[model samples]
Target: MVKKYRNFKEVGDAVVIYSDNYINDIEGEKLEDLCASYMERGFTSIVIDFSETDLVNSIGVSILIGIIEKVRDCKARIAFSGLKRVNYDIFSIVGLTKHIEIFDTEEDAVNGRVPQEMVTS
Candidate 1:
C-alpha cells in the first residue's frame, strides 16, 4: 500500500514523527533530515511516535539505527514510543532495544526514567 506521507512536529526536545504509512529508505532520509535539524537547533532528546505506524521496513529500521548512532555522536538519545508487540519484537530481535530506549507513552518517553548509560553519557 502506498500510504501518504504525513508531517512531523517538534515539541520542546522531542520531534514526533507520526504517520500511518510505513517508513522506507526514502522516508528515512526525511527522518534523518529532521533529526539533524533538531540537533543543529540544540535539541538533543527526541521521541519518535510510532503509534500510528504499524510497520517499518528494513530501510526504515536502518534509518532508526542511524539515528541511534548519530545521537550517540552528539551525546544525545532517542526514545521510541507507542510501538506494537510486533514492532517491539523487531526492535528486540535486532538488539536495538538495548541501544535505544522505548516507552509506552510520549509522557513516559519524555518524563519517564532513563537508562543509566543515557544519563552517564
Candidate 2:
C-alpha cells in the first residue's frame, strides 16, 4: 500500500507524529520533511507514535536515522512509542535505541516515563 504522510499534533513542547500501518521508502521523505518543518518551528521535543505501524523496511529505518540527525542538530529530544516486538528489535539492531527513548505507550513517551523493562544501562 502507498503510505501517506500523516499530520502531527502538539503536546506542550513536543510534536507527536502518528504513523501509518507500514513505513517504506515513500513515507521516508515525507517524514523527514515533516520533522524538518517541526524543527524550524522551534519544537524541541518529538515523539513518533507507531501504534499503527507494523512494518518498517530498511528505507524506513534510514529515514528515521535522518530524522534523528535533524533532531540532534537542533539539540532536541525524540522518542518512539507503541512499537511492536519486531519493530523494537529492528530499532535495537539499528542502534536507534541508543539515541531515542522507546516507550510501550504514547502516554508514557509523552510523559517521559520509560518503562522499567525498557531502561538500559
Winning candidate number (lDDT): 2
The collision pairs in model 2 are none
Q: Any runs in candidate 1 off by more than 4 Å, and if so which? A: 1-6, 119-121
Please give the lDDT score at residue 35 for candidate 1. 81
Model 1 poorest 10 in a row by lDDT? 1-10
Clashing pairs in 1: none
User: Total clashes, candidate 2?
Assistant: 0
TM-score of candidate 2 relative to the true fold = 0.83
RMSD of each: 5.4, 6.0
- Model 2 bad stretches (over 4 Å): 1-6, 113-121
Query: What are the per-residue Cα lDDT tens digits for candidate 1 across 1-121?
Result: 1222356666666566654467788777887888888788787777787887778888889888998788778877688888988888888888888777889886687666668887566
